[model samples]
Target: MKTEDEWQHCLTPEQYDILRKKGTEAPFTGKLLHNKEKGKYICAACGMELFSSEAKFDSGTGWPSFFDANKENIATKRDLNHGMIRTEVLCKHCSSHLGHVFEDGPNPTGLRYCINSASLDFRK
Candidate 1:
């Protein structure tokens, strides 16, 4: 876990907000929202491998959507924020917020990992 100071120093305000403070960026504004490259999406905070390019798909949700993730690199918990119940996905190593996973998704895993681009670093 990173101290508040460490997080502040390493992350930009936007990155810290989404990754540490659990905030969401506006839809359709994410850098990786339309990314079609072949690479891995890694945690911006800790460089942990989270999702593979092969698992990515255009869900049209304006976020970087993936049907599946590197399951072992992620951890989830029940979140009851905004008067709604959702499963919050976080980086397993750093516990930084990535986004939420939902059941409404494509084939294979049938899960949608709607992640914030600010929370990720794409390597192609």
Candidate 2:
């Protein structure tokens, strides 16, 4: 595990704010929102594989949406912030905030993992 100082030093300001501080990137502004490449999305802080390109879909919600994730590398918990109750996703390996997951998604899993691009790095 890396110290907070180490994370700050290694990550960009946007990555630190979104991954470490649980901050959300502006909707429709994430770099991966329109990405259709075949690859895996890994945690920016820990390099843990989180999502596969096969699971990605355009949810029209402005964030990178996935129908499935690398379950072993991710975790979720109740989030009651901003006057709403939601499930917040995290990178289990490093405990970095990734984003949230919702039930309103396509068939097969019916899960929409609305993630922040700053919290992830793509590996093709």
Candidate 3:
């Protein structure tokens, strides 16, 4: 496994900033926002599998939003930053901040797992 320092060296400054520091990438700038493939999205920090391609959908939100995460693969916490209350999602094992959850989502769950591409590693 790559150590934390190795990960820092492997990713670019912008990737490290957003993946490790919970920073946001500019809207409409994520490559995965329009990806349509059979794969899994893992945590860039620790390689923990987070979401499946089957759960992905287009929300016109300019980010990768999933209807659900892999079972027990993610952890969530209440975020009170940015002057608003939101649920912050993290990789369960790595605790790397992925993104936030909102109630406005499509279908069965009604949950939008809006995530930053910088925080995820796609595996086909």
Clashes per candidate (backbone, < 3 Å): 0, 0, 0
Q: TM-score of each candidate?
A: 0.98, 0.98, 0.90
Q: List the residue pairs that clash in candidate 3.
A: none
| Model 2 regions lying over 4 Å from their true place | none
Tens digit of per-residue lDDT, candidate 3, span 1-124? 5566976898788778886788898878998888899999998877889999998999998899998888598889999999999999988886778999899988888999999988888999
Candidate 2, 91: how far from true, in Å?
0.3
Ranking by lDDT: 1, 2, 3
- Candidate 1 — which residues are off by over 4 angstroms? none
lDDT of 1: 0.95
Reference-based lDDT, residue 35, model 3: 86
Q: For candidate 2, what is the TM-score?
A: 0.98
Ranking 1 against 3 by TM-score, winner? 1
Q: On residues 1-124, what C-alpha lDDT tens digit does candidate 1 reach at each position?
A: 7798999999999999999999999999999988888999999999999999999999988899999999999999999999999999999999999999999999988899999999999999
Clashes of 2: 0
lDDT at residue 7 of model 3 (Cα atoms): 62
**Which runs of model 3 end up more than 4 angstroms from their true locations?**
1-7
